[model samples]
Target chain A: MIDHMSALFTLGNMQFLLRGAGMTLLLTMIGCTAGLFGGFLLAYARGSKGTLTAPLRWGATAFVEIFRRIPFLVTLFLVLYTAQMIVPRAPLFWVAVVSICLLCSAYMAEIVRSGMESVPAPQIEAAEVMNFSRWRITWMIVLPQAWKVILPSAVSYMVMFVKDTALASQAGVFELMFAGKALANRGLDPFLVFATVLFAYFVISWPLARFGRWLEAQLARRTHEGDRR
Target chain B: MAHLDISGLEVRYGTVPVLSGIDLAVERGELVGLVGPSGSGKSTLLRALVGLVPPAAGRVVLEGKDVDYASKASLRGLRDHAAIVFQQYNLFQNMSVLDNITVTPVKVRGRPKAEAEAEARALLARVGLAGKERAYPDQLSGGQQQRVAIARALALKPALILLDEVTAALDPELVRDVLDVIKDLAGEGITMLLVSHEMGFIREAAHRVVMMDAGRVVEVGPPSQIFDAPTEERTRAFMSKIIRH
Candidate 1:
């Protein structure tokens, strides 16, 4: 039996994997923050009415569709290879993080657009009639409600977002999966190392999954109470 | 001076005209009830007053200033002059009842938070929501939510207040509480333009009644005159239909 007992005591290799876990968390955090911002711009472009709206909407939609259609690994390759040629001097960490953000932003934009659509037209009309400035209405009214309505789904997406960060290993980003492969190369039992990697993924994903479920229950309760009233 | 003057008003959603060639006016301190069946341009008219609907061709003059030409800065300034309560009770869901009332005052008007919140609390108390200041809109009952909406509008202390079917969404039993608040506002001589289907409230509170049909003012007169002796057959027909039920 491959012993987790032995692996736990292997201090030197464990330190390397722990360091990689730190990198993984950092990549997920940076990628998600950038993705969320880019998604907001995409959603607003899709929502607005103007001559450029059609083209902008099309571009944003296509960007999302293309990334979503391709496998995450392939998208990572395209991002890394193109970026390395364009800006060879930039750090590999940035290249990996930026690629993940670009890929994830498309899905985030769709989620946000759906949330925005769920907001009532009258709420927006109320803001306008009150003569609220565009920025004030968005920040004060629209986005707050949208965020509440979509928060559960967003939490669920974060689990996927974190798992997807593992794909950054393909770009030589030295994340958790990359660390496991390095340990395997040094004659560590491959099954034990990969199992540990799987366990780590479970640890990250499980609490987040439970939190998402709790959020959904809370939202449902509030909506039910709203209807009852 | 007329508080509101709308002339040659035309509104459309794409190619379909919802309201066309509409002209209306309300003098200061007049409580005007805009009565009409659903889709009769009553909501459309209310929306146009504050530039929510872009009128295809019209002039909306408020206090001798053309509202159409007003910039965004001037528009927010005008919000302090006129506040609105929607039928849906479109309160900010994320904010407490007090914050809902105080946001425009503090954020939009640049009033200090403490002072704005103080004004908000007083208005909430006036509307029978004193203890519910910290409750979010979703936490309040529908009637309470609508009252908070009224308090929020009142916090602005505008010269004119537009209420578009404010009690339409409330339970039948809860409707009276909201109407009572409106009655009190009218008694206070606050200039209010109300769009509502509650005939009894209209008769009791409105200084003038303007009945609209097919996007035109079918009749405009004292409530006694319109209710007792409507001039137009269409007005008489509408009254009979509503009163029969």
Candidate 2:
């Protein structure tokens, strides 16, 4: 066991895995951050009413539906092939980023839309009586009230997304799983290398789960405090 | 001219007529009570006045001016002069009592924050929710929230107030608190069209009562006539079925 551990836990090997973990972290941070912004725009477009925005609502719905139904590996390859055609020689990292963004935005839009729906209709009508602009009502009243409903689910989606980013390795992007594959191919025992990879994934994802629970508690407490009656 | 005049107003929800060919008018400072059974279009009439429900065909003359619902400016002008209090209170759950009252004045009307806040305090006092400026809507009783709704409407200083079943949702004991505030507002000579089920209060407080059913106004008269000597057979049936103790 000691000899097996020594072979697996060399300083050079540790550095290789740590760097891969760092890359995975960056990919998740960028993809999720960008996805969140795009998802908000998509959801607002989806929620838009009236004839003027009918096309936008339809398009947003289509985009979310299409990307959500597509498998992640297929999306990566699709982005890869599309990027090759649109801008050949683009870095594989960007291809992976684009694919992650597409997948995350589709999922995030659903999470946001459900959150927005949880706010009662009366809250919106009252704003209308006050002659508040639709934008003002959404930003000032709807989103604020919706946060209590949205936070826990949003955090959980993001945690799930962190795991989803692992799929990027299939596209030749350097991330955690890709590093483990490379070490196993380099004559290290497959079980030990993969076990270390699993531990690394746990190390990253466990804090996210804890943070989501903590945030959910905080939001629940705020709602309770406001609703004493 | 009457303060608000409706002639041949029509509203439909996708081929189902909810209110049709409705005609009613209220003079300035008149406290008009609109009492009717469920689905009688009492609430829809008020919602139509504020442009919440689209009017398919009608003429609404307000403050001696014809209101064109197709025109956004005209609709906004109508809201500026008239406000509706919903049965559900419809307070902004995210905001405190004070912000609920002051948001429109300060944010939309461009009134100074300090001035709007000061007037909101005064309105809160008038509604008997003086110290609740910091409380959220969920933290208050239904009666208190309804009072806050009233204060929110009054904050706009509207010339016409539409009360759509304002007291319908309150607890029996809590009904008096909201009704008392409406009574005080009526005594102050504010023009109002209140839709309520409290027949006894309407008889005592209304300058005129309008009886409606099945998308039409069955009768319009003094409260004594509508309640005691109702001219319409529908009104008599409705009056007898209220189950008043």
Leading candidate by lDDT: 2
- Please write out the lDDT profile of model 2 over residues B1-245, one tens digit for every residue: 88889999999999999999999888889999988878999999999988899899999999998999888889888888898888884898888999899999999999999999999999999988889999989889999999999999999999999998888888999999999999888856579999998888998889999999988999999988988999889999888888453
Candidate 1 C-alpha lDDT tens digits along B66-132: 7753356556656668888898848877677887888877876798999998888888889888898
What lDDT does candidate 2 reach at residue A133? 83
- lDDT tens string, model 2, A47-78? 99888899999999999999999889999999
lDDT for each candidate structure: 0.81, 0.88
RMSD of 2: 2.2
Docking class of 1: acceptable
TM-score of predicted chain A against the true chain A, for each candidate: 0.85, 0.94
Q: What TM-score does each model's chain B reach against the true chain B?
A: 0.95, 0.97
Error of 1 at B187 (Å): 5.8
The weakest ten consecutive residues by lDDT in model 2 chain A span A220-229
True contacts kept of each: 0.66, 0.61
Task: Name the regions of candidate 2 deviating beyond 4 angstroms.
Answer: A224-229
- How far residue B76's Cα lies from its native spot in candidate 2, in Å, is 1.3
